[model samples]
Target: MSVLRRVGMTLGLPVILLAAWWFASAGSTSFFFPPLSEILDSLVEEWFGPRLAADVWPSLYRLAAGYALAVVVSLALGVLIGTSRTVRALTEPVFEFFRAIPPPVLVPIFILLFGLGDGMKIVVIAFGCMWPILLNTVEGVRAVDEVLSDTGRVYGLRGWSRLRRLVLPSASPQIFAGLRQGLSVAIILMVISELFAAENGLGYAVVQAQRSFAIPETWAGMLMLGLLGFLLSLLFRLVESRQLAWYHGLRRAQRSS
Candidate 1:
């Protein structure tokens, strides 16, 4: 019953939102805010039909490649810094400095350095995504119970084996949290990069549509972006649940106690 209620709530919320939007935009005067039915019709004809196949794939490809690269590099560096006090001390300040800067501000620099190409987009996404994962991994590693380390040491586990067997598993939940954050940031940067100067991707499509006063098509592109972000977040949550079930169970146990 609880599960069914949860499912209903999830599905019902979006429907209510759409209904509200339909009514609210029924008589909108703003060129940007077309009626919901017109937007939906445009979305179906463009986003779901032809424009989607043409533009969405390029954007999704960039997102996938850039995000995946960020995850791999960030996880490796994060684990290294997390395990090593000296490395953390040496790099943390630099990491914090770069992380503090808003990613959009770097677009011009990236464009200059790498040009308006896949390289530029990938690097921008990776830079934006790295900090969250790195910081979270550090926290996760730092938070591992000392007793577990002691147990591993007592069991003749050392170095890589200890990290793989003890630290990684214990830190998985926090690391996943960071990855989710990083992925979200990556998506934003990916769109921003394309929006400003690119010849491809959904962001470019949106800008083009807006400039041409194709308001309905512009809304359709925006809707596609929202859908993409939603889908990515949902995917991350599913992976997190599957991988961190034990961690969640432990958390529940501790809370109950």
Candidate 2:
């Protein structure tokens, strides 16, 4: 199919489904599933309204802070362990044990330890985001071509110079793949933390709307969360495309060979 046709099909599917939903639920008055139009109206009112902006900012701030910390810490540790066999062996079991545990299970512990404030939420988000990044970084480092390492050594590049010039660039694509995975986890944990115990956030808004039986408002929050996730993933893909342009070019050349 043509690119424009493909794009039209993609956009048309959602529009069709939404139209069907709006029409199907037009006659219903149940709180379980509000009409699509009503939900859209509520979304516009809540998201575009001045008062709701306060709640949105706090949630975004916490998410950004938590995810940023996770990226820095996990990437640093992952690179360190990835480069050192001894360090990787020493930390493997502990990392596996923690990674196996579901993030939601730690919510109560975090709340107890850090209270019901922003600290607990940030920690939870970081905890959820770290594993994917760490594991991916390790894989990325391991996947670096042995020939590249030998070439670097022939040039007398060692230690930090080797890592900075050879290893990191080679590993960047896989590292980015892990980062994309971690971003989704971060968003999930962010909402879950807020849903469980938060005074202000999109998740809190959803809970409040549900409690009040405002079905349209609840749907609006859910839609907003989906949009947020989509936007974040798209942003990551744009960055990945630019950062890994050389990798893509190499792959294209290999395919033609």
Candidate 3:
């Protein structure tokens, strides 16, 4: 498609929706549903204003820390489980049990153990997000071609060399798929953790605004959240596309045929 057409295709629905919302709520008198323009104005004045750093920075820090920790732990555990039958057999049930549990149900336990601090929230987010990455990696590693494994063994690729040179590359696509899912989960948990107990965060801001009947601020927070989610997803796909460019190319070629 032409650049203009592609842009239109991507933006058409959003534009229509925004226009409809703007027109419909131009003179909104509802306490809960303020005008879109007012919401945008509040978004700019509050989020873009002095309170920005106070609310945003802490949340970002916790999210980054939690996500990074989960990625490392999940990848390590996944590799171990995927490679070792003994470990997999021993731990599969435990992992499944934990993964099956809803994250919110464990919030109280986390809070009691770690208090309403950043550490608890970070751990909660990490716990909530790690399952997808770990499981995906396990499946990916186990699914590697036997022929390729034999070929690598023939070449005497052993230990870390074999894992780095063969296993990780083979499993990267699936690992990344898991990572994408984990990222979405992490975002949700980040917000939820903050909502449950936080001195500051975007989620806390949203909740506080609603409780105080600051309808415009509440809408502003929602807009900020939507924008953040979109931006993060976009950034994630950019990274994934780069890393899996070869996989994407092969798929495209197959489609063309």
Candidate 4:
């Protein structure tokens, strides 16, 4: 598809929804649901200046730190557990217990341990996001074909080389699936973490606005988060496409055959 067509297809629903919201809420007198135009104006006014640097950057920073931590730790632990049946068997029940708990519930515990600071928020986000990626990585590593493993061994693809060339490539699909899921979880946890005892962040800003009866500003903050999420997801898709280009091509060829 042409770039213009692709853009249209991508943005069509959102644009339509925005238009509907604009018209529907244009005459609204409700304090909670302000006019879309007013919300947009508030977004531009509040976010286009100092608040952007003060609130937005901090939130983004925490999100990146937490998500990066999750990805690294999960990949390492996942590989270790997946490659060794003994480790997997020992860890499965513990992993299952932790995974079964809702991440939000741990926020209070984390706050008590780490205090109400960026450390607490980041840890919360990382802990919440880790499970999906970790589980997926474990499954992917376990699914590697024995023939491929033997072939790699025969070719002297030992240690890091074996993992990089054989294990990682074969597991990339599931890892990416987990990464995608984890990204969403990370965003959610970032906000939720901030909602509790946070001085600055997108969630804190929104909650403050609502408490102060600045309905338009609250809506604006929400819109900002939604837009940020969409942009992040789009960026992830682009990166995923580039990284997995060969995998996608192979799949297409297989389907054709």
Candidate 5:
């Protein structure tokens, strides 16, 4: 498709939905269905005004910290489990059982252990993000070509060098896919945990606004969360595109052929 056509296709649904929402709710008198214009005003005044610093930024910080921790731990354990049949066999069942237990179900336990602080919420978010990443990394690493390992050995690439030069590059595409999944999961947990345990976050702000019958502000808080999630996903894709440019180039060549 032409660039302009692709852009239109991408934007089409969201634009249509937004337009539909605008017109359908334009004359809304229902408190629950405030007009989009009023909602936008609340978003600007409530969120962009001071809630940006008080609620939004704190939530972003928690998300960043939790997700970053998840990435590091997932990659480390994933590499170990992926590269070793013994480790994978030992851990797979346990990991599977844990992953099956929904993260929210464990929220109370986490709160009990870590208290209703950032620590509890961050840990919850990290746990929520870990499973997909761990599984994907294991899949990626195990799929790395044996020939590449042999080639690395022949060239005297040992231990960390072998992993850095051969394993990571080969597994990166799947790893990044896992990272993207984990990112979304992280964001969900970030908000959900905030709703329950946090004193200050976008989620907390929304809860407060709703309890006070400030529907527009509630919508505004939700809108801020939506925007934050969108922007974070966009940033991840840009980074992924940059890092995987070579992989993308090869795919393009194959498609063209």
Candidate 6:
């Protein structure tokens, strides 16, 4: 399809739904479900200026730091564990135990350890984002075809070179899957972390608005979050498309055959 058509296809449903909401709520007298137009006005007034710096930027910074940290650590540890049956066996129980615990439940402990600052928030976000990526990486590394390993060995690929050229590339599909999952987790954890002991953040803003009975402002904060998540997911898709172009091409070819 053409670019315009594709764009229309993508946006048509949301636009339609938004229009329905706007019309449905046009004459709303309800305090909780205020008119959509009023919410939009509040969204513009609240998020369009100073809050961008004071609230949004800090949240984004924490998300990026935490996500990057998770990705790096998960990939390294995943590769190490995947390469050794002994290590994997030894750590499997511990990994499973930790993974079962909800990340938010540890926020209190994290606050105690790191204080109610950026450090605590970053750790919470990282911890929440780590499991999916680590598990996927381990599985992906372990599932590499033995035929490919033999081929690499015959060509003198060994140790670091083998992992660099063969293992990583082969495992990348799963790695990207984990990264995508981790991104969403990181965003959620960012807000959850900010909800507690926070001076400023999107989540904190929403809480403040609700506490003050500024219903429109609360709705606006939520709208901002949805928009932020949608935009971030789009950006991630663009990156994934570029990174996995070859894999996609191969899949297309296979399917056609």
Scored by lDDT, the top model is 4
For all candidates in order, the CA lDDT equals 0.87, 0.88, 0.92, 0.95, 0.91, 0.93
TM-score of each: 0.94, 0.92, 0.95, 0.97, 0.95, 0.97
Off by over 4 Å in 1: 27-30
Q: Flag clash pairs in model 3.
A: none
* lDDT ranking from best candidate downward: 4, 6, 3, 5, 2, 1
Estimate, for each residue in 40-122, the C-alpha lDDT of model 6 and write its tens digit. 99889878777888898999999999999999999999999988999999999999999999999999999999999999999
Compared with the true structure, what per-residue lDDT tens digits does model 2 show for residues 1-257? 69799669656886897789889988878768777888889888887574267677788888999999999998899899998899999999999999999999999999999999999999999999999999999989988899988999999998889889998999898899889989999998988899876889888888898999888888888888887887887678789989999999999999999
lDDT of 5 by residue, 1-257 (tens): 69799679867887898899999999999979899999999999989998889988888888989998999999999999999999999999999999999999999999999999899889989999999999999999999998888888899998898899899999999999999999999999988899885789988889989999999998888888888888888789889999999999999999999
Single out the weakest 10-residue window by summed lDDT for candidate 3.
50-59
Indicate the worst ten consecutive residues by lDDT in candidate 2: 47-56
Tens digit of lDDT per residue, candidate 4, span 1-257? 69899899899999999999999999999877889999999999997677799899999999999999999999999999999999999999999999999999999999999999999999999999999999999999999999999999899998898999999999999999999999999999999999999999999998999899998898899999999999999999999999999999999999999
TM-score of 2: 0.92
Q: What tens-digit string does per-residue lDDT give for candidate 3 at 1-257? A: 59799679767997999999999999999988989999999989999896589887888888899999999999999999999999999999999999999888899999999999999999999999999999999999999899999999999999999999899999999999999999999989989999886899988999999999998999899888877887888889889999889989999999999
How close is each model in CA RMSD to the real structure?
1.7, 2.1, 1.5, 1.0, 1.7, 1.0
**Over 4 Å off, model 6:** none
Q: lDDT of candidate 1 vs native? A: 0.87
Per-residue lDDT of candidate 1, residues 92-133 (tens digit): 899889989988899899889999888898888888888888
lDDT of 2: 0.88
Root-mean-square deviation of Cα positions for candidate 6 versus the true structure, in angstroms:
1.0
Q: Of the pair 2 and 5, which is ahead by TM-score?
A: 5
